[model samples]
Target chain A: MTATLTRQAPQHAPDAAATLAASTPSWSRRAKNRAASAAVVAAVALTAVPLALVIWAAVERGSARLDLTLFTHSMRGVVGQGGGLLHALTGTLIITGATAIISIPLGLAAAIYLTEYAGGNKLAAITRRAVDIMVSIPSIVAGLAAYALFSLILGPGTRSGLAGAVALAMIMIPVVVRSSEEVLRLVPADLREAGLALGSPRWRVIRKIVLPTALPGLTAGAVLGVARVIGETAPLLLVAGFTDAMNYNLADGRMATLPVFIYTQWSSKGLDTAAYDQRAWAGALVLMAVVVVLQLAARALPPQIAKLRRNR
Target chain B: MMAAASAVALVLVGVLVFLAVNGGPAVTAGEGELPAHAKNFLALAGPLAFGSLWVAVIALALASLPAVGVALAATIYAPSPRFGRFLGAVLDLLAAVPSVVFGLWGLMVLAPAVVPGYEWAHAHLGWLPFFSGEPSVTGRTVLTAGMVVAVMILPIMAAICRESFALTPPALIEAAYALGATRWEMVRAAVLPVARSGIVAGGMLGLGRALGETMAVAMVLSATPSLISFNVISAENPSTIAAFIASTFPESTGAEVSALIGLGLVLFAISLVVSLVGRRIAKQGGLR
Candidate 1:
């Protein structure tokens, strides 16, 4: 859903008269226009100010002690002086990688079903609507859903990185579906028609022609889906309780994530409160860096890849 | 493919079904470890649900005017199209930042930053029940949480409104201008008429988000298990269901966990209703 920044509506109607009127407007109309513009600009400032502040805070506070040690040592049983987020870094990567693994294919298949086979089918529409609604469901609900499902299957108190990954996957799936559907819809119908004319079956056409044509966009969409979920603290904190030590096994005991690490570091303060605060800020900084990079890639890569395809 | 689509469909149902299946025992037992204020399920849920909706209402109210202003700036008021798109992207950055960061910022930076303002409001508007209490010494109040959620949802509402606003027929705008309408009047006649449903739908969606939002409220508000906060700036603020569940679920045992599940299910139901209605409105408005 955060992919929307890159995927705005395709239709941009250029209105020439709009430019001309502003230049030669009547005095009263010009004054009114100026006032309204000023108000809207103020609103934009109001919204942007908070973002600038948060990013500034994250960068300023986080860079103080961000060093090799943060990535080298796990914060296992150390009070403050010597510790790192090796455990959290591995845990977040593993869980999110697993989340992507699980959600991407299921989402791709659902997108293909909706685009190629379902057509205007009623069940398809309901299914599509369901997916759309699911996009806005609370992230915590996903955590609860995963928690309930796993607890039922594994009995009470089943906490694992796998459960956390599953929770994140639940959130990511709908996002992947929505973005994949958007990109899939952009494939030229004539391409599919040509494939069909070449005696290929429908599935063959989708697999060969449609998928290749929309490959870059699909990748971008998947990346954006991951970006959306990577910083999720609520769900992971819910299903995968935090641990200080390194735990690589998905089905093993509680695992730490960067976001949850940031949360826990602040809440469970130690004797050295400043150390904990610095760790939290550094974690936030690292997490923000990853999210921003993924976001930029999601926005920038598709067009470049499309251009490459075109040049080829 | 069918199975994949069904998986998506199933998850939507599974969220509700699991909440019901796991939480049913708690409701049947109807007497377990709940918050100090709650004697039964309804007592536990009623105030929490109300608090959640009320806080979201405050947030929506706070956000709607500025959100529309943002949509208008991006769609009709920008000097150039490039500027509008840039502004939109900047807004999206707000959405991309995780809520935990916002929570930490709220608790650390924003809460203290607004203490003087809260004291001023409490001093001036002390006669009003809603502003009567001595301002929270720590500045972590329902009002502060509302401000945080308002900022969080502003972009969502603005994005939806920007989509619909951009779709306003250029011909309609030109026609209004041709009829000698002032800039504000033209926007009122053309853009507002076209994007009204979008504004309403966006508000509902934002409300849905604000209601279910957990981290900011959990980390910011100094809330207790109480009836709804009549005085939003008071330290004795009410906890939202989502925040309550987040704080409670970590250590909860047997019936208590089930009760938290029940609370979450109630949250699910309320937010589900809001989002479904939002979807219905968006469909009616023909927003994608």
Candidate 2:
């Protein structure tokens, strides 16, 4: 009778508790999956907030002060309002241009040597490590190094746009080398072998075939380096002493850049100073625009150049 | 070609030598007023070094949580491939945003916005030493600077972790699913285990950045050049090495300059060691 009752109970409750047990695990799993998804969504949104806030604040505050004079006139003696970022803009262009001129060739050459000649040797490893270390050096330290180097050579308190450029170049070189090296490594080994088999010297092959193939990527890397250093404030703060007047010469005299201009405007102002604050916002906006445009160009150039080559 | 490569090595050596030579005086004999007599020479390096470590630690801890989540979202939880790609681009853009711009925003916008929250923390969580201070209205506390650093490093950490997560073996994930595992379970059993080392390396890399970040910290922190203090929310400025160099270098003369350089050298060494270790770990984790 006990055995018969047990068998009967199993048959009666098979679709009730048994089925519930089978579905409970899946229910909990589904709930866990939903919670994880929600957590990811929350994370993405939270991470995006700062970027959105910065862009929004820049646009809102910057647009109020945007005008022709703000771009055309120099802030020579303007105390609280009026004038523009003309000197700062010109100085930024000159300093950044000088930095690019200094960094690109040296960086490209280092990259070529690392990729073509070094070939896992101890020197190559050391060079690679040095580049890595350089990549992480603080911009302010780079500024100090440039300051010390220039000050010692040209007497103390010597501030020049050239010194600032040197400091920026110090920061940019490692970036250029690393990025260019990565691109160079991506060039197919088979292509190198074929070029060698065709009786071209190694240098000629690298110069003609590898470099041309890597030109777009190399440009991208150089542009990335420029983008990285163009907005640096601390190095410029130490090396390029602030100048309100327009200074075309990079070798002598203090000059101003957008970053430094913004910093001075913001920091030098006393409490409740609206005009300087407004100018700072406008300068920040312009700087952000420049950086964003360069970044877009960097991203777009490689693909466009590749397409052009394919068409040719 | 080899000469060019060696030039980079030479530059590295030159920088180190320059710092050592210039900063040597200050490091050996500290006798200068840091903030026009608020502190003496001996007080400079210790406080700044401690401040750097303190802020960087807090920033790293704060950033890692959201960074890991974002990486997971982009890699494993995105609604579609295109969405993931879009999210990746956004993160890249965030990474590309200038540090100074971040500083400006932190000082102008974020500082004011967080005043209430800081006050609330000070009021309610005062029992915790980290929150035990009278909150300032300006919001330029060490905690605020740390949050700014956290924001700055988030994209970097996220990008690295996302790349690692994307490289997780699909076969393992599929096997987990085949064993009747849920999506979260599949990630737990396969993805997390595979990407753990990469995530840690990425966090360390971010920490390296946080350690050396200058303008943002300089702008946001009130920067009291004092000895180490646990009071994070107070108006007492916590001076960091990079920030100290930047703010003081302009007006500093003589041994003061040397001392700032000394502080810079210390910062450089710390960041170098951190980045080297991070790079090694990242390389070992199979990231190029």
TM-score of chain B of each: 0.96, 0.95
Q: How far is each candidate from the true structure, as Cα RMSD in Å?
A: 5.8, 6.5
Query: What's the C-alpha lDDT at position A33 in model 2?
Result: 88
Query: Can you list the residue pairs that collide in candidate 1?
Result: none
Predicted candidate 2 versus true structure: per-residue lDDT over B1-288, tens digit per residue: 898899999999988887888777774563344443535555777788899989999899889989999999888988899888788878877887778888889999999999999899989999999888688789988888999999889999999999889889988987887676778889999998898888989998999999989999999988777757877788886789998888888888877777788788889989988888998888888986
| Weakest lDDT window of 10 consecutive positions for candidate 2 chain A | A6-15
TM-score of 2: 0.93
Q: Write the per-residue lDDT of candidate 1 for residues B52-77, one digit (tens) a residue.
A: 98789989998998899998988898
Candidate 1 residue-wise lDDT at B29: 51
State the lDDT of candidate 1 residue by residue for A1-312, as single tens digits. Answer: 766864574454587567655557688877987888788878998899998999999989988869999999999878976688889999999999999999999999999999989989876987887887787778888888888988999998789999999899888999999889988988878888989998999999988888988998999999989998999988888899999999989998899999999999888899899999988989999998998899888888678556745664
Angstrom error of the Cα, residue A99, model 1: value is: 0.7
The candidate scoring highest on DockQ is: 2
Fraction of true contacts kept, per model? 0.64, 0.68
